[model samples]
Target: MPVTQAPITPTYADSPPGPPVLELTGISKRFNGIHALNDVGLTIRAGEVMALIGENGAGKSTMVKTLTGIYQPDAGSILLDGKPVVLKSPQEAMQAGITAVHQETVMFDELSVAENIYVGRQPTRAGGRIDWRRIEQEAEALFARLEVALPVRARVKDLSVAQRHFVEIARALSQEARVVIMDEPTAALSQREIRELYRIIAQLKAAGTAVIFISHKFDEIFEVADRYTVLRDGRFVADGALSAITEAELVALMVGRAVNDAYPKAQAEIGGPLLEVDKLCHSTEFDQVSFTLRRGEILGFYGLVGAGRSEVMQAIFGMTPGVTGNVRLEGKPVAISTPSQAIAHGIAYVPEDRQHHGAHLTMPIQQNISLPILSKIGFFLRGHRAHETQIARHFAEQLELKASHLTQHVSELSGGNQQKVVLGKWLATDPKVIILDEPTKGIDIGSKAAVHRFISELVTRGLSVILVSSELPEVLGLADRVVVMQHGHVRRVFERGEATPEIVVAAASGIELESARQEENAA
Candidate 1:
């Protein structure tokens, strides 16, 4: 939302929220006879942030698409200010004062910031020429109003990830958007950036814009949203004020059951060392990184961002060149310089960026799942259709993947399902050692439980796993041993009993072990 010239006093802070600005009743959408959203209902009042709560595959993405006019609901009624309106296309939705900022920032990299803001509908001079100057002025005004200083003339590609998101918000403001949808906006943002976003949301609230905030982070929802709406299996379960319910109740409403443990560690017998890395070195990212993965063990590499945790894993998986490392599998030295070689040596890597690096979005689910093992079968799935389908279905079922059919494109699935598809593809290879980086980054709590269970099952089946994550609890709960990395080096390796949250976090931040213990003891 654009910053206003006047003082930003949130009108909704003390006063009660006003009437509904947007409402959806009896919304239902289907795909190949499968219900994506069934009889879903929602309401968003003016000057309020409504937290759209749901587990992955619980129709959050479908509702977002339906609301954005990317896909028209087969059965539903949308009301704008108490009057029913039809959103036939995205253009119509935008014209009707609704704009969406997706989790994945989609912008024209070649265009300037101002140009991107006014891309489709640019103001014109007398003869319909693009008013570049006016666009820049308006863009600057938007940033000024938001109190964010972004270079309006700079190319979009040159900006930071946070800046690009601000530009997206500025674009929505430029449209005079009355109702804005933010889907996991903080997924890629730093904590400071997230606080800035909260400030922006407050300003938008002050200006009376109804914001639909979609997120799987319960803390974030409770922090920013004024109200709550729950959807389970594509149906409305409840809606009310945030202060009226607890987080556990909200989770239960969204998932249809009580979650006993956020991280359900798998039980497996640990054997001798399965893989060992000695002095793993990258030119810039990391140095002298050494770790060991035992048989049937989940070895976790935990660190803050830019700690070279992912780079070390990538180098081990042979995706990074100029990586000098001595890798031994089951006490036998193995030389690998490419991903195929790594896979041939029983190594698999599930990357962090699932959309770009892990899964092929345009490919069918069956094809994507069978991609890693195509040589074991055949190409194009011509004569090996049954085998491919059988293998795909096996892992999809194990992963609890949701889809219309195995032939459906991965692009059409929700974010959590896409992550599952990527996992299914790599697991199809049946590798002895798998490196999973940020495996549950964008997935919901329920789906996360499913994934945690699956990872536990992997170790029980004798597959050694290396888990890298920025989430502290996940690493602490699931990993048999935690290897803390800071800046490019291993700070400490803690046994399961020794890896306390406070101590591990301090080590990861480059504090001395003794000091960490002292602080822990003091606390």
Candidate 2:
């Protein structure tokens, strides 16, 4: 089993418990004769953060939808302040004081921040005309309350990911939400942004709001939640105060077994440099970036959001325009101007945004898996079905991808499974080098471990990898060498033995190495 850390005492552990603002009793949901949730029960009291933990496909999404009135439970009772109530729709749920800030931060990109915050319930004047002035003022006041600064008049599309999330929270609070559910809120946030979110949650709790914090991150659960509830195989496995349980216990509850290690970074024979970038520069994104990846090695790129790590990766993958760089593969210069050219040059990139860029949601698993190699399988489409199925099944089984069948649509699968399909699709290209950006960003610990093991296996088989991740532990655990970047500049490079959490964090955050060393010495 992975070494267990000391149990952390939650911040609100000793607070006097209040009556539950929302309670779910004997909840059961089914779809097409498949039980997604079975007799599950949960209670969220005011002024507390209750962590909802589960593995992917453990019915956490179903429960969230049911609670938010997107899915009506076949059998259950929802109690609002101990009174039975039925939430027939999302509007009804909002009217009943329930609101959610989803992981994707659903909002209209073209709408201004103030407009998005008050879209459905825009402030009105005497004649029912939109009071745009009131909207902006109220939004500004709301952001001020959260201690966050955001331009209310700016369009949502121009805002950063973290800024958009602040708008989502502001919108939730504007709805007078007494029960605020945050579903995987930190999946895409940087460490600093996550800290700010925690601060905001604390503020919400102090204001008597009940928050349901759902995430696969154990550290977040222990740090912020007063209580935790675990679901396994669509059934409630455990529920208790956060201070009373340990991380090891929580993992066992979620997966029904021990995970020996989250990162199984295998040692592989390091060969000659497989891919090299000399003075790679992207206009307005990143500049003067340089790195080298070797055969059977995992090269990690670490940076905070806006640090231009992803931008650099995209440029290398031929997705960014105006990229000026010299790329060498096996000591030979290669010009990759498009994704097809990159693929032909034996390079594949599994993008971070899997939903929008990685997979074809409407296509079948087999089709998505075979998409990269369709041209090779006869363009006339004669006798291609069996060939496609064989290819899909091969990579699917190789990656331990779980799906109803190869014909199943990618959209029907869970987040973890969809990620697997993305990985499978790329592996089908038989590329010498692969770039995985935030490979396990939103998946559960079990799935993250699986992906890590798979990546290690790929390196062992002589495939070079460039892993871009925001999670420090992941970078430290899997990378043979780490490239730290800050503000579009290469900050530092550390070998495996030399890199530590402190060192990487300092480099990524622009802390001078000598100053960090001096601080360490003073300590």
Candidate 3:
């Protein structure tokens, strides 16, 4: 099936003078019975930021994977500069002037920043030996071009998460890629970092490099995208210049329905604190961080990447060692030195990276769901299959997880489905307080709604939650109170009604919201 390209209105600074740098036509792909993509067509012009929006399982990822040679299309044709080309591997894609920065930063923690930047293609000197001095100088030059300041000689692990993300971008710029694909690039960045990234994108546009920007953030799309393309049900639905549409309309195109309301928050009555931390101090990540979570309340921790949000959750979950803190659950101090202790005391932590920490991908969904509470029923042989099945079925239905059965392998599921499994696993434990870090990252619109609904249900059941999210909307929508953190410390707190994107961004960037408000008031 051929997708009809919507007539683009001439609104921006006009199409570039050069030929289309990249073009894909009749791109079709499938896995088993699932049609991952259906005859998708796209064109990338020089010096333009093309935003791709879609629901989960909408084939946005499939199209990119095919373009980058991670998955060859079952049927399709790709043209580079009007000439047919076959990108059989990632190396081929890079050699063809196509590069990508994935949502997850890919780098070697043990290596120096310079080394990681130019890992495979290092500058060589005499005798074909790697030229260390030239590599450092070139890496520094790349960072300078992207307006990123970092020590090229420092180990990658020593830098902050946002810094590491910039290093990845610097690496891409080092290649001088003509077409760059950024998948949720700002998903883990602060407002300052995001602004810096937009500046770099502008530079790339000025340099005549085409950019494919993928994000769920509507404000970012409107702010940075030159044109927009929406995908739904593995097919292209709409495309045009950004100015041709409103945010609500764009969201409708992506989800294939009107989103009259993005946030569905309902106020809850205040009550006694269910969990409290008094003078919590970790060795280095944070100090004197004290807060409380109450029953039926959602407490949001907002911060830039590496601002100690995850570290705080770690301490509360008993994963951080050498922590001096007095924690009380229901007015009683409890000794929590490990995850088991924390779980026993009714605390659950859903980590940021589900692939690495949340669940076992190769295991059956039932096994993963029952793993956390396995000790109570004895290993796989405890005759708890009936009970486990019931629990898994309940959550699967609750989360609307798509799978054949509880015996299905989690690895075969989609990103959103896998996330539901992680959530189900934790919910089975029946914890008093749940700590969620980036719970909706990479999930599609439908799945994101399901997760939000689950959170609301949890709170209604009198379970307190501490949510750490990179998406500001999620924080504002779900949190009863918001705490903004910066450089490993709390910067400010906002009541439910006062939390806004502008206010949170200002706080995260180390600017006093009240001072700005006072200046505005005076004006």
Candidate 4:
């Protein structure tokens, strides 16, 4: 049977917090005279989940590194239970029972789950020989405690994003951590996976572990956190009990402005179908998928992870091999066997994994944006630097891309900015149909709103969009039509007026829909 969760309550609100297990008093850090953390102070008590909320580039990462001993603070002090201590290095921090689970789980891809869990501190038998059995047993015990199941001998690269996150949490627990700092733990998680993570957090709290929960998601904060701290532009804004604050106030504190209508999806004059996919099938991934993307329309594809949403898009974009389907652009049959062909046929795909598949991280923003239009710009790469800069600047302004300059390398930008760069690169192609897969993944709420507004703007300009996202709110708020997929098949298609959370979720999960159909047939 699947693990069932009880209705979550704010249990920590009943009792007053005891003395803190960890405290940061007047902590200050500067990089080249620019203050990242200026006189910042925080406290995390035993059995408490303290939410650290901030926007992207708001010094949250810096403060985390300071706590984990990646960088020594320029001033102020750290106190553990009122006792001052200096954490000079990551090793010392781990030894002191302070560990972190980063947003991006770092592990050896080639290593087994057990090996990755017990990487630095492997159990040893007599004669200092490695005890592989003990490692696997301990890893299994940890998963059992967390109510997660995975093969201990399986390689890390074979694991899904959610499973990798579990391994990271298990690794932190293996350190005997008194305090675990979880950085954006639910960024890539599905709704069900997020609930399970909350259950895990509850387990840790019951064990008297202090959790520093860092996330940009306010809903998760109010759900799991006992107390909240807000940071803005490298400065401390406020810290209070979760019960004593409202989400609007927290957002105001973080962004220094009130954000009204996060999803500003403007209605556009949707024209005839710009792209058509007829029974598109990919071997082992997705199969028998069909959809129509009309001009100036936002067509959303919603499904659970491993439901073949991304795979279908990849096949449509010519990224996957063994793809069998008929694709028509503007009602004309077009064979897209490669990305270059897709682009030539007025199609652009901004992939889900921007770091790996989308952007040239080491290259400057201008060059990255000019990549698709390199041949169009000039005869040679160096000859059109000026032309490239002009095109990059146009999109940067249109997209409201936040960066120091176009010459800045994409790698140095934050997650939101990097995503904008990826979007800019594709938008420069001036395609009629744009496929955005998880466009706002890992971005802050403010940036998400920005991206949403931009999508609306794109459609208003007579461009069609295929939005694929795990985020239900995004799909419901923006899509003119939503296609719910299950097990590589389009289960149901909901018009904008008909789709709701209840109906859409039921269709995607393959629950209630079949029963309702059976009842209708019986009648």
Using TM-score, give the best candidate's number.
1
**What tens digits encode model 3's per-residue C-alpha lDDT throughout 1-523?**
1112334443544557778899888888877545778988888799989998775457878888887878888888999889998889988988888888887877899999999988998889989999999999999888887777899999998987678877877877887788999887886678988898899889999988999998756678878888887887788777778877765455445444322246566556668989998878887788888888888899998876557889989888999899997999999998898999999999999998999899999999999999998887666675689888888999899889999989999999988899999999998899999999899877777778888888867787778889998666678778889988876788778787666555565676554445447645775
List ranges where model 3 is wrong by over 4 Å: 1-262, 378-383, 512-516, 519-523
For each candidate, give its TM-score against the true structure: 0.62, 0.59, 0.60, 0.57
Q: Once model 4 is optimally superposed onto the true structure by TM-score, how far is the C-alpha of residue 233 displaced, in angstroms?
A: 21
After superposition, the stretches of candidate 4 with alpha carbons farther than 4 Å from their true spots are: 1-260, 379-383, 513-523
Enumerate clash totals for all models, in the order shown: 1, 0, 1, 0
lDDT of 1 by residue, 152-184 (tens): 989998987778889989999999998999998
**Model 2 lDDT-worst window of ten:** 1-10
Q: Between candidates 1 and 4, which one is better according to lDDT?
A: 1
Candidate 3: residue 322 lDDT (0-100): 95
Scored by Cα lDDT, where does model 4 land? 0.83
Per-residue lDDT of model 2, residues 1-523, tens digit only: 2322344443444544767799999999977456889999998888989999875567888999998889998998999999999989998998999988888888999999999999998989999899999999999999999999888999999987888889988988998898999998886788999999999999999999999999755668888999988887689877778888765556546545322357787879999889999999977888899888988999999876568888888888888889997999999999988999999999999999999999999999999998898888864687899888899999888888888889999999988889999999999999999999999877766777789889888998879999998766677788999998887999888888767565565576554445347655775
- What is the descending lDDT order? 2, 1, 4, 3
| lDDT, candidate 4, 224-312, per-residue tens | 99888777667887887888765544544554532236667797998888899999987777778888988899999987645788888
Compare the candidates by lDDT and give the number of the best one.
Answer: 2
Winner on TM-score (1 vs 2): 1
Select the stronger candidate by lDDT from 1 and 3.
1
Evaluate all candidate structures by whole-model CA lDDT and list the values in order: 0.84, 0.85, 0.81, 0.83
Residue 296 displacement in candidate 4 (angstroms): 1.8
